[model samples]
Target: MTGFIVPGSPEWLRLITPSKVPAILGVSRFKSQFTLWHEMAGSVAPAPVSERQQDDYDYGHAAEAAAAEYWKWKHAGWRLSRGEVQLRNPSLPFAHLATIDRRASRGRSRRVVEVKTARDLYEYGDDGSGEVPADYAAQVLTQQLISGWHDDADLVVWPQYGMPRIYKVPFNEAVAAAIVARCAAWVESLRAGTPPNLDDSITCYETVRALHPDIDDVEIEIDEGLAVDYLELDARRKEIEAAARGAKTKVLDAMGRARVAVVGDVKVADRRAGKHSIALYPATKNLSQIQEHAA
Candidate 1:
């Protein structure tokens, strides 16, 4: 709170310090595993994994697609920037990549973009037709609030593939306040070491159970006379997991709004039809070590 200050108005900055910035925007890829497992446990039928599944575990292709999409948006004359950014509240503070795209329109600069991707996209409804995925809606709303606050602006949705679709959702101070409050509650839960136990809503419980089948017993609540111990632990874990999921959804939604600008190019070092390895950074120096030295 000491250094988290803005130049002019309360909207410009959050006065994030070095120590807190990492926690806020640190790479959370690893925490996702535990969160995903926790969600699976909350499922109605709680299907624990017999043995870890591999199909969904690997997402190399998705990463590639994400990178490529960022590039395309950049090439299309969109301003793109990449790197983790910080977002905070009283309970917790966090950061994520803040992407922005600006262009000239009608002789003036215009910005309209969204934070999300094809992976985040889901389908539902009677005939699998829905205007917008509910999860995505919640996430986009959060992004809109944050963007509006710091940038003094709003964002739009530009679908990366399929039907050329675009959306414009208005943002207001009220909506931003609501989002901050929601995030504050989540942060408070984290601080207290007790994630909120949203009613074992049938949808979430079932989803968790379906994802993780290891836990033989999964329940909506803790019945003291019945299996009580496992219930407590399971619920607590699931709550934490759900919080993480919510955070991820928010961050991804933010990125989807702004185009990405990768610092370096990716070179495929190795590949085997289905899988491949790309250098994390550009290869600057030659690797002469692979050849045998004069023997």
Candidate 2:
């Protein structure tokens, strides 16, 4: 009951782990609830992991150990239980499971510690405030709910640069209860063969494509209203695209030989040399400033 579960294994596929809580709550950037539902329902196979994704996973595991060591050094008195331990509560449904990165305890005071590697601190709060990403909060909350270590948890984030920072996440009983309720309902839905509605997430789109890879040489009539809506949306999209292209050309012309275009202190666009051609990437952080500057 306390060990790492092999990912993609039969048992792992049947249960909802702490990491999957984000997708269940529609907060995960990498996956959608619909995709998770189908994968767990055995309707479609999980997508094959790309080489880049595999490399990230490998780096993450290695970073976890380093993070644990850092946490131990910071809290010398606290006993750190470092391992990929899978914790489960018999009282709850088997679907509700957790595999925490580390658990810290000092004479009965126990807290969960989660290690994360981020490309930047854009999604995190650099201030000492305990603000963290919603997906990460969900994962920690699920871990606390399962482990019964509900006092508080720590999030150790190792950014691509700089030293790792620790964020203290206080437990909220209401949020934990809500998570459990939603997960239970999701499990019931999966048991009843009810899949979640589709969304525009890339994972959901990929899942749908995989579900129907073969194209049938047949025509079927869709709703007339839906068809009209699609056509109108397509026209609007093309118009917007054309306007964007014209604006981009104007910006590039203004830049001339300059590699970067900035509005005040904010960088609006930058040119990068690609294999075939030079690519212009827009930052879009201060679009209003860029627009005013352009005007």
Candidate 3:
């Protein structure tokens, strides 16, 4: 007697969910867990803040000055500088708070502070002023890890239209180290051409599928076509992987959500043409292959 596994079974779905894909590929475990931690430590939003969006918001001079003042108050006289800092391992990219702004009052100890400014602090609190974005929290933690000064980071926020807010959140060395290790592993996974399997109870694959109207009727594939398309797929995968620098769990989750949006758009286009709708697959194929096959 001979036995063969069925292709595209429920078992396959269970194995390839967004949560499982990261583990299957051994990618970005930090993103998987950080998502959970952020949810458990939620302030208000159903989803956590995204680092990519935060980075975009942190560009400019007023923002930097406000961050400086906040750190000056928080660290109490620690020297503050700008630019990147390199230590033993991977160099840390810190734009604003490069130096210590405060000195120790009683002892001979100094702490490093990071100031991140944004237009909205509503997520953090409405303390008549702005608060630091949670997205920056992870960035600061990452910086601390590279600098060997874990848990000694602070965030200073300046809302565009309100008073500035200062917060000192001690970094957890163990957690930061794990996050760095996970990120490094994720990079390796990307280099190995595998999808990172990151699991989150809150981040579901079904949510992504549901956003796409065509996902219900997605076609399964198993043939030489995949092999023919593999080279193109590899290129696209590398592009996606390249976009992962300084990305946190929330940002990656947002990208997944954006994928859902793209699928919805495709479905809408098909509906307009009175044709069969196709769900947007993950970047598993090259743009050329997609154009060819889709055409």
lDDT of 2 at 263: 72
Q: Is candidate 1 or candidate 3 better by TM-score?
A: 3
Report lDDT (Cα) of residue 59, candidate 1: 39
Q: For model 3, how does the per-residue alpha-carbon lDDT over 99-157 read when each residue is reduced to its tens digit?
A: 22222222545345555444445423332223333445555555455555654555666
Better-scoring candidate (TM-score), 2 or 3: 2
Task: Tell me the whole-model lDDT of each prediction, alpha carbons only.
Answer: 0.36, 0.83, 0.43
Write candidate 1's Cα lDDT for 88-188 as tens digits: 33332443222223221222343324433232222110112334443334344444444433322322232333332333444455755654554454445
The residue ranges of model 2 lying beyond 4 angstroms of the native Cα positions read 123-130, 239-295
TM-scores of the models, in the given order? 0.36, 0.82, 0.40
Among the numbered candidates, top lDDT falls to 2
Using TM-score as the measure, the top candidate is 2
Q: How accurate is candidate 1 locally (lDDT)?
A: 0.36
RMSD of each: 19.2, 4.0, 20.4
Candidate 2 worst ten-residue window by lDDT: 120-129
Q: Would you list the rank order by TM-score, best first?
A: 2, 3, 1
Q: Report backbone clashes per prediction.
A: 32, 0, 17
